[model samples]
Target: MKKYPFVYLACTAAVVGASLGATPASAGHMTHVVHAGQSIQKAVDAAESGDTVLITPGTYRESVTVTTPGLTLRGVGRGVVIEPAAAKAAGTCAAGGNGICVVGTKERKVEDVTLASLTVTGFTRSGVYATATDGLTVRHVTAVKNGVWGIAQEGSVRGVFRGNTARDNGDAGLFLANTISAEQGATDTGGTLVERNRLEGNRIGVTVRRLRNLTVTGNHLTGNCAGVFVVGDENKPRAGQVTVAENRIVRNNKSCPKTARLDALQGSGIVLTGTEDTLITQNVIRDNAGTSPLSGGIVLFKSFVGTASERNRISDNELSGNSPADLVDQETGKANTFEANTCQVSRPAGLC
Candidate 1:
């Protein structure tokens, strides 16, 4: 929530910038190869901007931090693993208890850093944590058994997270936030995309908190305590302008104990709190049943901070077997619409 005074870009330019990551290996970009016994940090520290550090298939007992722009840290195959060292690892990445960290300051954002085809597990905190980055891409990585998020980003813009597997994390499988350190207005992401990922066995599959201008689409989420959560609070530039579409969220009935900030969670498909102008459409949500206040197929609950959910649209979703109701609107928010959704039950009746 610390103030992220991003220079707002034109709409067209923002859309273009959203797709600016994923730079292919060019003719001249250097590639540093690391063998089984070598250190990845040495290779990464030796790399310049726009360089590639290609790691071979091996278990690397270390944490990696990337600060250079346009750098690619890619593993050759799925056998490449990164975990904590025997002793305490060094640097801020290990201090943060993350397997990998892509860090940048607010004054200078890291641009176009990519992480692909690796497995980072058994960390005390997040498997992969990124902050203050632009055009970051994380694809085909497996993050499991972490203490917190599987993959997380904050104060970032134009990120692409696709084709990843995140399971059995202590918290959300995928988490994106405006800022976790302070209270401020939502930050525009310039259309970040979260697509086609497999998320299961976490507290929540995906959590988008106090962020705007992003799309969560075509993901498969199940076996978690909850599916997708779009969270907001009473702040300026309200968290909205998001599209949640074409995802399969089902049977997330794994019970999770209540945290300091939230109630105990179970069987929640998609929940939106204190958000405005968001679209929840075309999702297949089924068999999510529990007695929690937030449990439902698609729910609109009053925010704990007392902000009303306003001007949101829920349409064209297929829902069934959800206990209490498939569609629950527990708030008296204005301008909220529920139309064309195939569901049997609703809280105040007649919203099917």
Candidate 2:
């Protein structure tokens, strides 16, 4: 009986050793090479868990969706292109197709994927949409000439948008909206970090609504309709706090003459309405020319909440050729503080 037990142990050890030797150390890191005549969706379909689909440099004229977790879709260099069929559609284009969408139920990540180093254009809706996903990172990417916003994120949490360039989009460069119903109120959709991005020539540079604990810093916003528009709903009990600091917001002077009543209503470098607990500090708000009256450097109007525009410690912030001074339209029910601001332009009373 003792001899039989020893033989069995030896046989089990040999079988385990053979299995380990046959497999590579990083067998989990499988690689799927995507080439010509292969659809990008097929490569994603063939990917197992924790696999990386390495796409070689080519023009791929198809829209892709990522539903798998821990799967990385990377381009060889910067020539990986996915052009849609039509210019604009909500989810997909009737003329062009849709762009890449990450619609994972669990948290997923998509990184190091370049969009338009070789001219991938013609999409409706957005170039990239990260909906109901978490930990999605879009870095070192360029999205240009899209139908709507360049990058749109809805119901996404803990996402990072860094080193991305968005230009000539139909709407805002980056549109982030948290439209959870009141019954599903305040679902902590992760804190969004937007930094070091070049957002220009869009309808709006960045539009944020119904979010919490957002930090937008070190970005360049120029030649858009509005630099940064922060809006919220008054009926909601939860107040979203935003920190806008150390950004260069200049020359968002697009005209809307037909909406002269609207233009004369609200316009500025940083436009805020119905938002609370916002910190607009250390930002260079300069040369935001308005098409009509009621425009200035940093304008806050009709905000029935509390904000602190102090210690923006604004200095050397050149406000030239703008009709009004640095701060304008100090209304009721909104508490704000303006301190240490240097403005060179001339304005009327109560606009300092």
Candidate 3:
């Protein structure tokens, strides 16, 4: 708990605008600055499109839900934290009990939401959760000690998550699940970029579920149960095209409890559970645990008989000193090409 210079105002004239008048969307950009002892939710609720909410450095113990588009929540510093309230003490936030939850319904189409320069923690599910938005940007944020993911996005499109630090959580530091649904439809159909983030000491560093055109690059993932796990299920087989390049994915051998999800899937750097057309290139995949048959620097495996991790290209990766082996491909994987990699490979895997 670092002390920041805060404006100790009981009630300042900085209340959000009273009545909304018709203003040009291009010209009317307002900013509502809230101090400590004030309600940030009030500022967000009263804010119109293209308005900005600036919160001063302070600790706020409440769950925030913002639904408007083009609304930005900018904190003065990372010292501005939002912890869980007593009401949010439930086991999970998937049913709407999150620290900072931003949602846009399918019929509403809220776009251009941003959450930047803030620290959110101590929630039941995720520290920050966003879903079904047209374009969402979460930048320079910190999420720690949360129940599930540090940042979790589902059914969101055009998301840019960068320069974030997520650690010591119940699940992955960052989790993105962009799948088709009856309510959300096809989201993130274009693509999503996850770059230059730090993930450590979690169940999984980063996890993707049925996403299309996902680029995961320039990330440092270490000391997690699994560094990166991309999977598609039996129902949705086409999990999308993924490119994992230029990442320092190493030493993801964090031990989990016997009751953990994928408990045997530990000590692996990257696991392609069931995705199609994946290109893993130019990555430093080294020093992973490789405890299980599936654990290694990289693994291409399938969950079921019919479903397979297909059409993958694993090339030009530096690997060494793994417990089990450098690379592994289960019998269910099909048509995966492994070539031109610099590493000590397992049996049946020869360098090109």
Best by TM-score: 1
Across 1-352, the per-residue lDDT of candidate 3 in tens digits comes to 6533333222212342333112223345666766766767778877777777778778987877888998888786687898876553432333455788888876775698989889998776799988888778888889998988899988877888888888888988999987423322122446688899999988889988777788899999998888988867555437748888999998888877544335465788888876788899999988897567568888877743346888889999988876677887774567788888888866455643
Off by over 4 Å in 2: 1-25, 86-97, 105-120, 180-188, 256-267, 292-294, 303-321, 345-352
Weakest ten-residue segment in model 2 by summed lDDT? 4-13
Stretches > 4 Å off in candidate 1: 1-26
lDDT of 1 at 120: 94
Which model scores highest in lDDT? 1
Error of 2 at 297 (Å): 1.9
Error of 2 at 253 (Å): 1.5
Models 1 onward score TM values of 0.92, 0.76, 0.86
For residue 8, give model 2's deviation from the true position in Å: 38
Cα error of candidate 2 at position 13, Å: 33
**Candidate closer to the true structure by lDDT (higher is better), 2 or 3:** 3
Give per-residue CA lDDT, model 2, range 148-243, as digits (tens): 878877777777788777788877788777753332232344567889888988877887866767788899988877788766645454435777
TM-score of predicted structure 3: 0.86
User: What ordering of candidates by TM-score runs from best to worst?
Assistant: 1, 3, 2
Cα-lDDT of candidate 2: 0.62
